[model samples]
Structures are given as C-alpha cells and as structure tokens.
Target: MPEPPRPEQPSDDKVLRGLVGAGPSQLSTHAALRARDASQPTDEDLAEAERDLVLVRRRYVPTQNLPPGIKPAN
Candidate 1:
C-alpha cells in the first residue's frame, strides 16, 4: 500500500517568528527583523539628527549694534 503524503512545512519567516514568541503580523522575515535591530540609531546618529535641525547664522550682530527702536530681547 502507498504511504500518505506529509504535511507542508511552514515558511522560514513563520517558523523563526514563532520561535521568538512574536505575533504573526509583527515582522515579515527573520532577516528583516535582524536588519531593523542592527539599524537602530546610535549616539552618533542621534547627534547628527540633532545637528541637522540646528540653524546656523552666517552673520552675527551684537545687541549693541541694533537700531534704537528694535529690542533684541522682545
């Protein structure tokens, strides 16, 4: 008599996520999860992002040099 066919194995994405106790909709694949973890912002990356937001004035004028009517504090 012929033997019955075996059940299909789950994909690597499903198997790996299941092993890590992650929900089904969390990540698509193990490699993608690893990549995301590895690509987290470092201290340098944070500093660079902050630096990008800073506005550097090309020319500086002292408060004493301002016009009489204009108040720099206000």
Candidate 2:
C-alpha cells in the first residue's frame, strides 16, 4: 500500500491574511499541519509551502513585526 498523505494547510486566503495582517503563528501552524504525514500532498506542494514560509520568515525574522518577545510557538 501507498504511504499516507500529509495534513491540510490553511487556504490561500487565510494564509495571505495571516501573513499580512496577523503574525507568524498562523503561518507556522499551517506549515506544521501541512508537514504532517497524512494528507497525501505532493512533494512539489510541500516545496512550494516551504518556499512561502521562507519568504515570510525573511520578511519578519529581521524586523520582527511580531509583538515584542511574542514568538510563534512553532
């Protein structure tokens, strides 16, 4: 039998809003869920999400848009 699928990530709308309006917590949670081994997402999909998360980190990791000391519990 084939391996199980990965979990579902948040929708693009939520992702965009979370990335733009909210902090990195939402994005990190979505990433963790997508990384799970049950949703059967393709490698390409995972790669794309990884790229998006990297870009997000680049945008916030330095300037630290998050509230002071409020780290995404990822």
The C-alpha RMSD of each candidate to the native structure, in angstroms, is 13.7, 17.6
TM-score of 1: 0.32
Per-residue lDDT over 1-74 for candidate 1, one digit per residue giving the tens place of the 0 to 100 score? 89899898988877556657645555557866787789899999999998665343445546445545544442
Measured on C-alpha atoms, candidate 1 has an lDDT of 0.67
lDDT of each: 0.67, 0.64
Worst 10 residues of 2 by lDDT: 53-62
Q: For residues 12-63, write the lDDT of model 2, one tens digit per residue.
A: 8876676568546555766757746456879998898876554435334555
Give the winner by lDDT. Answer: 1
Clashes of each: 0, 6
